[model samples]
Target: MNLFDRLLLFILSVVALVLGVAVVLVGAAVPIGWAQMELTRHPYNIVTMVVGGVTALIAIRFLFFRRRRDPKLDSVMVAGDHGPIRIAYDTIVQLANRRGSQLKGVASFETVVRQGQGGLVLTLHMRVLPDIDVAALAKEAQNAVKSYLEETTHVPVERVLVQVTELGDNNRSMRVWSGTGA
Candidate 1:
């Protein structure tokens, strides 16, 4: 057991001892004296005293006994007794990479996984095609990643942040949708 538990047990034992002595003195000695006063020598003297002492001893013994706390095998223990928190971090990043690359205006997206105070945070540094709505694309990608992560694991996504890393203008020359802007 730990030092705190041991200290608690010691305190309980001392309390029990004090109460036991008080029980013996009050129940056995005083009552025995009263019996001698009522009867000739002692009417119900010895029996009452023995019973009281025995009962007190038994109660004291029960009081000092304690229950053990559940311990862990690992040296690193955090958030005790909540539940299982075995989250595969790599899997969440992979989901982010895939989602970021799928944006219509995205050129390429790179990700950096950071461990924060709360949990793992995925930071996506995305290279987007120029003239595309970068802000909207970043928001969409963040939402997608958040949804996917919450669905996948228990560690929780503290932050799904996107950084615009670079720009590519190749898609502007495709001329496929020119009828609308003309």
Candidate 2:
């Protein structure tokens, strides 16, 4: 959650907790004159009932609610003759996927693009062939993805992170025959 959202929730929770405690105290006959007087009068009853109901609702909602995070990536601005062109986030991801697919050792991959301070950061989760050199392949994939994305989208790539999640066995036999699998 953001700072402002957390702060608002904190304030609301504190208010609700205090009001709830007061209501409970009055209900239990704690002998607080103001609460007793407020509870006894008809007009004050309406006010308390409304406030108590609202507070209960807010408390239940905030406590039980799960906030979903936004999955959309930030839009990129491009210079156009008439005006600025806004590029959708999915387009960048698509470009990254295409670039990553062209890498020889990759069996499958997923791409995530996000806006960073420097510019865009692209993270690739890739499963590759077990026979390849992981370090060299990762470096090459990073460079290729970075260069292709920047060149194709004209968006500056802050970083291209290639995480090798799995190394498949498809090319192991070929590498073994070629004496390079080890």
Candidate 3:
């Protein structure tokens, strides 16, 4: 929910809490003149019931049907004379993954594309061989993926982030030697 909706809910909750407390105090016969007068009046009771019912409905709406504001790009459009060419976000992700996988040292990788102010931002998380140079590999992957996406799909790539999450055992080796060097 947005800030306004959240603030509204907060205000409603406070008002409901205060009304409930007032009803309890009146029921206990606190002898407050104004409270007793308001509780005894027929119109006041109807107004309170209506306000409470509206507040309940608002709370229910917020709880069940709140809209999310996540950055999910379903498609990208390219301007053209004939018509706009639309490319699916999943297709872009697949292309980026394929380009990144060309790097021999990468064990596994995942690609995520998000819509940004300038254009689209591609993020890559890769598991690579332990012995490989991480800095060089990340840079190469970033450039390659950015170029491929922008060139193929005509989508402006704002940035490409490559995070090396794990180093795999691709370069590891096991050997055993006799104690006496036999």
True-structure lDDT of candidate 3: 0.75
Pairs that collide in candidate 1 are none
| CA lDDT, candidate 3, residue 103 | 77
**Residue 105, model 1, lDDT:** 72
lDDT of 3 by residue, 112-142 (tens): 9888899998899998876677899899999
Least well predicted 10-residue stretch by lDDT in candidate 3: 172-181
Tens digit per residue, CA lDDT, model 2, 47-102:
65566666766776775666675544357887778998778778988888888877
TM-score of structure candidate 1: 0.45
Off by over 4 Å in 1: 1-87, 169-182
Q: What residue runs in model 3 are displaced by over 4 Å at the alpha carbon? A: 1-54, 68-73, 169-182
List the candidate numbers ranked by TM-score, top first.
2, 3, 1
Q: Tens digit of lDDT per residue, candidate 1, span 77-119?
A: 2342686444344555676678767666777777777666676
Q: How many steric overlaps are in each model, in order?
A: 0, 0, 0
What lDDT is reached at residue 132 by model 2? 75
Q: After the best TM-score superposition of candidate 2, give how far the Cα of residue 71 lies from its true spot, in angstroms.
A: 10
